[model samples]
Target chain A: MGARRLAEMQVEVTVFATLRKYLPDLPVGGSKYIKVDPGATPADLIQILGLPADEVKIVIRNHVITELDEIVEDGDRIAFAPAIAGG
Target chain B: MTRKIVRINMSNQKATYEDVPKKWAKWGGRGMTSAIVFEEIPPTCHPLGPNNKVVIAPGWVTGTPAAPSSGRTSFGGKSPLTGTIKESNAGGLSGQKIAKLGLAAIILEGTPAKDQWYYLVITKDGVEFKDASDLMGKGMYEIDEILWKDYPKTAVIGIGQAGEMKLSNAGISVNDPENKPGRYAGRGGLGAVLGARGIKAIVIDDAGGPGVDIANKELFEKGRKNLTEAIQEHALTKKDGGLNAYGTDVLMNIVNEAGGLPTRNFSAGQFEGAAKISGEAIAEVVEKRDGKGMTGHGCHPGCIIQCSNIYPDESGEALVSCLEYETAWALGANCGIDNLDIIARMTRECNDLGLDTIEAGNSIAIAMEGGLLEFGDAEGALKLFNEIRNKTPMGRILGQGVEATAKAFGVHRVPTVKGQSMPAYEPRAIKGIGVTYATSTMGADHTSGYTIAPEIAGVSGKLDPLTDEGKADLSLAFQASTAFIDSSGYCLFIAFPILDIQTGFEGMVDTVAGVMGIDLTGDDAIALGKEVLKMERLFNERAGFTKEDDRLPEFMRYEKLPPHDVVWSMTDEELDKVFAWVHED
Candidate 1:
């Protein structure tokens, strides 16, 4: 019975502007959202999706989400923002 | 030419509206004003006193109904940062609307009572000074919204808190269509001059505007077609999703990859976390998590190339995108903070306070080295920016300029040239930009002579990235060409296409000549550019700056930038000889 009978949880992933190149399959607007397992954090999910964490400059969560150690929960939306470089 | 130049003597507060010289019709916009500043205003004048005059002018195409032609405001002021000539342009609607009022330039002279606030209103009704005590000390955003709300259709240019104290990095702001006074003349402390004048805001109500009179309708039509088509033909325009889509933040990764991206006061050429702070990363986060538009859409009316974004907080809240590469590098890599959201917030603070992001970034980096803040501390940067508005002692030290900040903190490794903060491009890695940084009359600046013209766009055969053998000549070519482009009011990025081919040049010539009733040739363009550069140089010379002042900081020659152990190798004699064309008999 060790948590085997419960349903798997899901975490939210959000990308904007040019970062869409990482996931082109995602539609133009949000809610083209992908589902990830509940235990996996945003960093782990980015790794699972092959996005290099080093390139992600801004991370938006509900609270003081620290580094890779921070965990994700159900219905939590994590934002990924890259540095903007033009004039 | 049916244009007028408004010259105001700040010493006496007398404004003169005079007709522009026919010779100037050949170089409209930034070109026209920079030329006027060089010819009329002696460069030896004190930058802040009545002796100095700031000329704000628009480009030839500025008032035209051309899309994305809304940018093109030029300000020529004896620079508080460089102690010589400083002219910086910006993207905003005030230039377009004001120029459309048939003005070649508007010169603001002399300061007003320190405590009183006055407003300048220009329209068919004529120019007048109005009281603005209610608007004093308000943020640019707040002031702009109120003005626009009262007038509804007029253009407003206002200053923020930092400008009131006459900080060296203060920038003037213009109201945008979205009511965001985010558009700015954001360089060389021009906003401080306005603040010093007790001029809180300028409300332009040119509703019944007398637009620039095109002499020949047929020629103007033909020229407009060429200019538009040339821009439209660019692959980036069609493929990269209008800069209007994401703003200029798209350059973060690209510049980082080129090895010219500046990090941590230019100690390194690249940031390990650059990708995280890139346009791509910001776009992704804004879309998926916050369900908001990362692309800000526009700064002025009819700007098709919306290269501006509203950088959001980590929770996908609004900050400010001004998310430019230089800003990102200065605040992020230069200060060792990799967080894009925090950088956006810092940009928001600068906009609200009316400060130049580049100098602010440099100041913060210097402060961090001085132990005022720890590396990667977002709260520390915010604290400094907040104090900037308050004009605290430490805040004044930081707002004064990068050189002053470094001196106050006793930091030897400060990145500055001619008392001005160095731009995003590392002087060591980009030797061509290094030459321009050293020799530009305006002090260390990337736009002075962009080597990226050669580095990014292969005008000449692409040499090794760090080689300096032919960089001097290349730099001269860029500086000259850039001067011409700056005057045209066309975006400098258009240089990639113009330098890459002949049609682009043809389009530019047609636009300038047709607009001003002249037949300008390619050779004429060369002469004009040379003349403009000569004027800038002459101003610097009159200010007592010689070839010795035209060299980069001492550290550039010794410090080896990582990834490539490159240093600024050009000697003073070589740099002097680089602009040999200027010495032609």
Candidate 2:
């Protein structure tokens, strides 16, 4: 089946650190389900959420650090974080 | 301005000053301290004996208004904990003050034959050695209060009961801007070295003293502007950025999500209650409390990127000056406790006792693993600190750090390298940091070289956190660059911007050259770092360390951490490849 023709899927999204400002309704470190098209990537969700491309620097999928182009699967836990560094 | 190195002998209570030699002219901070320590102290000398000396030096740009966040000092000596030449630095008001006073370094040598306590009042006139009988046995909090009342606006570097007992985990405390004894040169038992010297405190007043001399004013300003622009423009370091908004604990959730947050004494990779103790949670609590709590707090003056914070309690009162990521991980998830307030209290206790929070938390976790106390027992964890404060036998064992506590309890899963406990990052999950932890001269310290930038934060370029390929080279590059940064007197957080921005790195080197009126390049700065590391490695080699000491703990080799289910898989050859130049003739 083509990705474009597939049904919508839900991915759990959590924005952390300064990225939380983009998702004001969601609590910090708290996750919310977002429905997207079948071939949705972290970049797609980010666009859907209206987060600035420059502000969201890191994207984690299923507990692994990954690029924004990686497609999200249903029930996959996705996290967006700003450029955060410390020990 | 002429810089003088102050030498104080405790045996006769005498002070002497010497001009900066040409050989040590370019050295400052870790470079200065390590060079002096390797030259003066015997490699195999007993760390607590009269032969051992403590060298404290500020970094190259410290005390200058042009250098942002350049108020850090380095303390070097033979570590009683690691039995290696150790250099531990801290951010406080002292480093800048020391620089403004026209002093390059302070060397403390010899111990009094009699058990006498003394404190030094240092100023423009000279040093005044006075009796400190009343301040003996007091906590660092009390000592800071008492000393500040006597000598207002002066920076205090002192120890607490843990240091008095010469415990292995003791750390020298440096007061923050608020006079809170929270900043620390908190590793490798340097506080015990000072305490063994019979010194209670060294109060410094830099007012009316000659400030730092910049050789080329125009060049210094140009370099400083470039570096400051990078710091202010970077996403992680800029105003209201991640660090300024959430402080260092901002890494908690991300690390937890990546399955790199060590939990239950490194038994697990992720914590169930990570959110409760995360930086976001702390910010939330700070907001809810609406009292003395705040974010964007700077550890030292002129720090534009303030990653420090004040955590508060239910009453909206200040609980701790800064609840850092390492402290939160060490005292919270590492011990199976998730309460921020409890962690803050433990943090406060560690600060008061002049103890390294990482070592203390690891000790408590090891004790818990040994059946002394159950994991997640917050109250029991709180009481264990009292054991150190009261100097009980159990307390003595705990005060010696995680490795000692592990041996005392017969716990086999010891998480230490070179007799020092590991920091927040789990090497099993993040292979690159593991390389740095194992090969670091000062044991399993995260700050020795922070690869977390590329590995976890995607600062310069994202690397697979799980891969070990080329990590040896990666760690070595970071270690060398970090050594230069440490010597430059800027906070390590500056690396976040400088690594991603080329001009910032050049600006850092230019600042050093601009200050000394000498021609220097990036290669020279890194070579300086390498030289400092080689000096430290040679000292360790003379002190009986070998390639065998560069391996991770035995348990990490086989036992896999959960979530990612990874073990320390890097080969011994790969580890040997790092710092291979140190072995070259």
Candidate 3:
């Protein structure tokens, strides 16, 4: 073969608050691992999970609030939160 | 209705009503309380001494049924904890009732000559001093039950055993709509000030009282309609929105994800147990248990946000009401405990003992760091609360707050500013909040300036949470805006929508203008905020606080917190700029 597609990468994903409705199979406050392309971004993953872009206010990768377009690597831990705040 | 000031002299036990001075007519809530404290109390005098006075006031819109979630009361006094001029606001029936009674402010002055406790019954007519010896040495819940039996259909504000013990961590408790010892003016140890005055409680009966006066009915309706619509339309505050769905603790997972959650005595940015105590978890457990527990509860009547909750036990009995985000993080993540049930129990105990949950939880975490117990020890944390209840020497030390506990244990990594413990957000990760914690007049208060909105939640706009650039400006604007919100008698949560929507901000200003019949603009309202800050700064300066006291703890400067691995990088120059206008004034 002239070129072989890069191996699919696994990333741990968790959704919190109202966004939990999209990931119905995920237990409350629990996370699951999903396979994605090597150069996939958080937005790509969100699209795969069927989450609306407008509903998500924050995208966190490896415990840091990041842009939805930020690159997600293999074995990355990602979390999504809605527009929520309290003092 | 003619709004008047009622001065209660504790020395002679007399309550006298004085007409509101022309100079003080425009003030209400924190503005009214701070103005009174600055004028009456000597800065150098002992906070618990007779020279100090306590001022209780309602906001301009408090008693109006048309104003949504505006029934907030402000309590001001010289704090025994920090020796600073303190204004603590709470939500309950007290503000609405007091305002309806036609009182602008209730000033409690002097100290009792004898070592005895008394309660005051305030009606539309006058205040009556009643013997409270029978209710002495009781918890807040017990006090609420006893007081309601004798004074039904009224609002009660009182202190519990913690205040009776004259502990610096004690907070004044106010009854919610259900008469629970939940709502509180829970910071700065104002409860100790009240305890020192020998007053156990004040029962307010608004029945037969004249209601709040609105100078311009058409203007009031216009402003009220605008604000109500904004609050209803905003995604974070509207029905079935973020706050209404999950309460404030909804920020738990998000803060943790932002690497701003202070975990295990500020040593870490994220807690492995964050999920267990997150608001999402609370909502799920409540739904699963299907018990008496429920979310979307209001702390006071006419609150459309309804972000409070009632947590229940395994038996389906209610455990605690309104388990807040700050309380959850302080007692759960900061202390390294993950169990929601244990955190709820500790919250219940704090309410009963009239303790500030933030201070109490920080103290416990400091104790853990000192090796008194292991992190994540739920039983040990509960036992420490028992010590406070028993008034043991150890208990007394812990009840004195985070700084005191740190000193007692020789722990150098204390997370406090101005002798007050920090709330949930980690300063290292969120630089703007760090500036707020360092420079806030009432000590390290998050509500003083909540920059977490732009920094983490993407409300209004997004900013780099880890950077020091332009943070001082961000914090100053928030602090100034927050001062206006606090004085208006609106809950600080209103800041969420007002920041995102311009009309929401205009609507808020218009309401006050409508109430006072004054032409006030948004800029003028912010100027009012700066004016309040100036008074507070002058008071603190007289009380011996310098730019030196406006600083984060030494350890925060050196230690690199995990995840982001950042320290308190903002310099003294940056910190000084926050209140630079105060100094100029």
Candidate 4:
């Protein structure tokens, strides 16, 4: 048998507030699609994108706030933000 | 040295200067204004009648350069909109100039005897009342242009057509750093109060005036350095961070994604076109078209954290200075209009016409709901602004504010508290802010207690926006702290770093202590804040506000906002806990 190949899943990620600095090429509110191996989580994406965990105060998956370690599925939309406040 | 109090009696057309009372020694800004209104004005008096007085005062640190954002001037009176004691702060050259003139407060009292309009030209020598018949019906921009021609160095505070009509949604306009009539003490219908006084404008020229006196210059310098460094180092307030780079509209995407953006007049918590009006998009436009348009602009002369901006049209002509988060949300998402250009125009018109942007936007939304205009119709909204300028009957009804507009149009789902239109945040999505709206003395004012910092943005600490647990306590602390900050004349945005950086908070207290020549700790600052709130609550109590008045509108409690589908879940019992300190005694 040939070496087994793992399935890759693609997820759309958006960053906001100060975290947008990490993806300078992307405009504000613009999302980027990233492909990862099966069973990829928010934490894995954070590592892949090289964002500081402390700076990432919020993470939303499919419009629901999720944890950094929550498993992500294909076509999941994720967003990150730093500590920001305005009325 | 005793600070002077300048009191103008429009009924007699006389101005008097008196030494600051010993009782007002510790009071400044909101504290001073609230104390004066509470002590002098009768609670049962009509807000626009002769009995009500408008008090304008700067904080103790104002004009001293002790802090970068210490130029806020507080305008307080019995609000015609809410019938409650109100204090609204604005950033411009007025506060610093007033402080430099050695004036603690400029109180406008009693109504004019005749229909003639007058303008007060205040200088170090004295104040002169000039006939302002030429400026009677002009917009703020034209008024500023006329005043600046004669008193170019003076900071001008004036009203416009809305104020001339004595509309409840009218606001007092202050000239920005560019001498543009853009900044505003923009809440509680204080402009109507001024308008009722028949005073068109107040020109303050502080040249060769007595500047602010500092008690401990060394300590003040040290504290100021510490705060300046902290602000410069903070991720949010720093040069390239959210505010300086893109202005406050940077909050649009985050607030929208978090499901707390009030859209379509509070019917939904999210707007699909939020991204189009985001601060990022604004920065792109400014960058793509370079001229007079730029970010990192300061509203006042000494503000270090320049969160204001100048937006230009497609042809690179300036449209407005400082299209902030609240205006963007209220005029953009809340109206279901995603176009920034239209929102910018609306903002400019409101400033020029001397109307509060939040109130105008809320009233327009109600009109849309009532079928006067369709939702997302930018052209319709622009036409309504013209109606207001022309003082048509429909415009007059809408100018009365959101509640009046809703009643006139027979719409039930009005988003207001105590007759004042709610700001940008959706109450259902952010429960802590909802509590603030329900309990704030000024009615639906977000700046009174910015719990959005901790609840939605995690500035101080992370609190789940969906939960009600600990929200009452959280809101109380924020309110108390904000009251103190407002008294200090610092921009409320400084709270972002002050909450997280211990040194920053200590530095702020030290600056005040140094200025006053008194020993003050962080705890003492909080106590002063509580005292201000207590005085305001007492005024509201005398005005007949009970626990029943401290509540979100009925619809907010039942109608579930979309995305989260959460209603305003905080109980009235929880809201009563906000002022538990007053009851504890």
DockQ of each: 0.10, 0.82, 0.78, 0.60
What is the per-residue lDDT of model 2 for residues B147-203, given as tens digits with 9 covering 90 to 100?
999899899999999999999999999999999999999999999999989998999
Candidate 3's TM-score reads 0.98
Show pairs that collide, candidate 3: none
lDDT of 2 at B41: 98
| Model 2 / residue B207 / CA error / Å | 2.0
What's the TM for model 1?
A: 0.85
The DockQ score of candidate 1 comes to 0.10
User: Interface Cα RMSD per model, in Å?
Assistant: 10.7, 0.8, 1.1, 1.7
**What is candidate 3's lDDT per residue for B446-511, written digit by digit as tens?**
999899999998897999899999999998888888888888889999889888888887888889
Per-prediction TM-score: 0.85, 0.98, 0.98, 0.97
Q: What ordering of candidates by DockQ runs from best to worst?
A: 2, 3, 4, 1
- Candidate 1 lDDT, B562-585, residue by residue in tens: 756677787788888755555573
Q: Write the per-residue lDDT of candidate 4 for residues B1-585, one digit (tens) a residue.
A: 678999999888889999999898888899999999999999889999989999999998999965777899999999999999999999988999999999999999977767878999999999899999999989998998899999996899999999999999989999997888878998989999999999999999999889888899888887898788778878788887778887888889888888888998899988999999988888888988887788889999888888999999988888898798888888889899988899999999999999899998989999999999889999889888889888899989988999999999999998888999889888788889898899998899889999888777767877878889998888888888888988888888888888889888888888888888889999998899999999999999999998788999999888988898999888889999898678585
What is candidate 3's DockQ? 0.78
What TM-score does candidate 4 get on C-alpha atoms?
Answer: 0.97
Query: Worst lDDT window (10 residues) for model 2 chain B?
Result: B576-585
- Docking band of candidate 2: high
